[model samples]
Target: MPDIVSFNKGHYYLLGLGVCVGVFGLIATLEHWFSIILSEATVKKLFRVAVLGLMLGLLLPHFSHFGFSRYFQSHGYISCDAASHRWLHSVILVYTKNEMLCKELIEARK
Candidate 1:
């Protein structure tokens, strides 16, 4: 087994990614199930964004702290802990924007 070391970036990175993905997935799933008030087009867009966001979240751990920092360095985000914020916030926007889309879809079928 690998040794446990303090201040291991890999450990912290995994933790951050996990939290972001969990939040994104939970909110998206909740919206899909409980918000039966979206349109098909909007639903599709949300689902698409969710899938892409999920993929990004899953791959986040593979990147180094420096990589993430540099990649998002120009997006007006400061500090080394911005990746987690970016991921979660991006997903949340997608979910919120498409919330009505899912509702419309369910409403149309009724």
Candidate 2:
């Protein structure tokens, strides 16, 4: 049987907030430099670039999560067990639940 996953509103909210802030921060920093280079660009060009950036920003969290999981698994910070990958899944869940806990756990292993 497959494991059933549960959703926590707080976790999702935190993740969403984190993504939004991170994306906006990146956009702001990039815009400062891009503005200098594209000072003569049209509004339409800026709009297109913003759209593309938003799309990529939405995927950044997932990509970062995948990278963290891979690193943890390879470093033995998480276990491979029961042919289930249960430990790693649980760790990821805890991560979404409380990011501080995840950071502490990872750093504690050092």
Candidate 3:
């Protein structure tokens, strides 16, 4: 199987890019709507506040892991340590076995 760690890293990279684009769009929309009455400095300050709020909104839940960790586990979230161990085990197995047999073993494990 493809490395799950790399797969999830790629997924998060794309997700972060999407969030950047969305935040930029939000700021632009806010400036357009409020530019008539708001000063440029005020708009800039508003943008700062908006970005701060967005960051806090995204991160606050992680601060309290009481229910969140259980929710994540029940939803098939694998911890980083577990993922690294699994990947290392697979690499060792593949390296120690015959190439053709390793391929078959990997496929069968899937």
Kindly list the per-residue Cα lDDT of model 3 for residues 1-110, writing each as its tens digit.
33231222223333444565666666677658766555778767766766665565445434433354454445554433322223321321112112454445456656
TM for candidate 1 is 0.32
Candidate 2 lDDT (Cα, 0 to 1): 0.44
Candidate 1 local lDDT, 55-92, one digit each (tens): 66556545645564554444433332211223433421
Scanning candidate 1 in windows of ten residues, the lowest lDDT window is 88-97
lDDT of the candidates, in the order given: 0.45, 0.44, 0.44
Measured by TM-score, how close is model 2 to the native structure? 0.36
How far is 105's C-alpha from truth in model 1 (Å)? 57
Query: In model 2, which residue pairs have backbone atoms overlapping below 3 Å?
Result: none
* Comparison by TM-score, 1 against 2, better one: 2
**Highest lDDT among the candidates is held by which one?**
1
Per-model C-alpha RMSD: 21.6, 12.0, 9.9
Mind giving the per-residue lDDT tens digits that candidate 2 earns over 1-110? 11222222233334545555665555566668666433435535655565555554455446665675665555444322222222322322322224444455456545
Question: Each model's TM-score?
Answer: 0.32, 0.36, 0.31
- Candidate with the greatest TM-score versus the true structure: 2
Q: In candidate 1, which residue ranges exceed 4 Å CA deviation? A: 1-36, 65-110
